[model samples]
Target: MNSLPPLRQPCPPGTCTCRRDELLEEPGADLRILRLTRHEEQRLLERLENIRSLADLERLQQRMYEQLGIRLSVSPSHNEVRSMRGIVIDFVEQPGLCRKTRQAIPAAIRRGLERQPEIAYRLLDAHDLLRDA
Candidate 1:
């Protein structure tokens, strides 16, 4: 009779099933082995720099809306605006939008404007204020 090696226990719920030894044995096992080009690195750095703080992120969102006719809502309350920046970043990273950030923006703005013209007008007003400043 042939004897079998010990069987490993299953992973906990929601955990990956692959064993650490199995993963390590694979060539180029890490996802980040595919590296970014110099330009891609620079762009990533720029994006990171752009969102250093809530105020900076808010300005960025407003600029996107103003320049590209994309209407995104920032909260009326200052505290809410700070919290919403993280949400905005997540929204921008969502997949299946044709990889054209500018393209989806205008449509988003249009939809928001249709639902809440006052918000759109407020964004425009903020743009004017920034321009004057």
Candidate 2:
């Protein structure tokens, strides 16, 4: 009588049979996408680790910001943001990259936080960009 999650594990004794993750059971774990798989983290984080300089990091940063629907800057460093799902994502970036957010952060943008906590992604209401409110 409802919908199913897009991601999944093998049917025959897979590593995690967690269709109902403990995290999701927590309070405020809205229907937003706040979960990550180890495999995905490995793939994307690999690219992030290859960054050779601040410029490179900035380039990736820009791509992520623009492509991800985040168009607001609320700080000098990539501290964190909360998506419409209400999950707080933390990012670690340069001194002036300026973490961004907008109407609502997409679920896939959690890459910044999943890999190394180096960068976090959270969507904020364009009108309510708070510093962890």
Candidate 3:
């Protein structure tokens, strides 16, 4: 009588093992916190696509700060089995925050995700230094 919904209600076939597998957002949860102009996002994606190594990621991190006033972090994936790694971007400037931004950023929402051996720019959600305060 756990009476709890599955990770994914009506889970997709083959993804759930009746243990702990599938997960999904509620019916109407728009998790996209921040958004960039189409051109800005496209430019970011282009740089992400160029990440061929960790060094590249580091450079991108720097670039994100200088270009877009956003802090970006890249790290190796702990999951050896997975093909890629991860990156974390917090819009704040505290403990885990990035201390630099080359531009004056307007208020907005933002989030960060991870990268692998190759760079893949993925935005889970977004926050900000001022926003969080």
Candidate 4:
């Protein structure tokens, strides 16, 4: 007789065992969302290299606000903005690019935006950094 609780069936590797995991991992899981591109990744990595401290991150944050036309006072709790700021700071602090950047940055950026249009259209239209948005 089995003494322990019956083992649960293992989820298939390609199956959606966890909706949250699927949402987090799949790039094309949702079409309405704005995704981060390689150019933005490269740009962030390159620009972040110049930042060596929190002061630099703060300056960059200001620049992002000015350049991206983001008003923190208006959008006091914007995640997309904060995500971008964090990405730059995290990238700079590390010696090299994090392997998880491609997946992580876009997700973070999406989280930070108050609306899909903010990233899907407006920011892309305003900023020249993105190769194609």
Clashes of 2: 7
- The TM-score of candidate 1 is 0.25
- Name the lDDT of candidate 1: 0.39
Residue 83 miss distance in model 4 (angstroms)? 24
Candidates 1 and 2, the one with greater lDDT: 1
Could you tell which candidate, 2 or 3, scores higher by TM-score?
3
lDDT of each: 0.39, 0.37, 0.34, 0.37
Task: Work out the TM-score per prediction.
Answer: 0.25, 0.28, 0.35, 0.25
| Model 3: lDDT to the true structure | 0.34
**Residue 42: error of model 4 in Å?**
0.7
For model 2, how does the per-residue alpha-carbon lDDT over 36-81 read when each residue is reduced to its tens digit? 2335434534655554443454576576555432232332233343
Clashing pairs for predicted structure model 3, backbone only: 85-115, 85-116, 86-114, 86-115, 87-114, 110-125, 110-126, 110-127, 111-125, 111-126
| RMSD (Å) of each candidate, 1 decimal | 16.6, 13.9, 17.1, 17.6
Top candidate, metric TM-score: 3
User: What is model 3's C-alpha RMSD?
Assistant: 17.1
lDDT of 3 at 40: 55
The 10 consecutive residues of candidate 3 with the worst lDDT sum are: 102-111
For candidate 1, lDDT tens digit of each residue in 1-133? 9974332233354444334345446775532211223344345335534343445546756754453223345433322233212223223331111223323444443444445455444544564534536
* Superposition TM-score, candidate 2 onto the true structure: 0.28
lDDT of 3 by residue, 1-133 (tens): 6763222123255543322121123444321212234445555655565455545555776766664445544333333224222332334331211111111121111111232422232221222213334
Worst 10 residues of 2 by lDDT: 95-104
* Worst-scoring 10-residue span by lDDT in model 1: 89-98
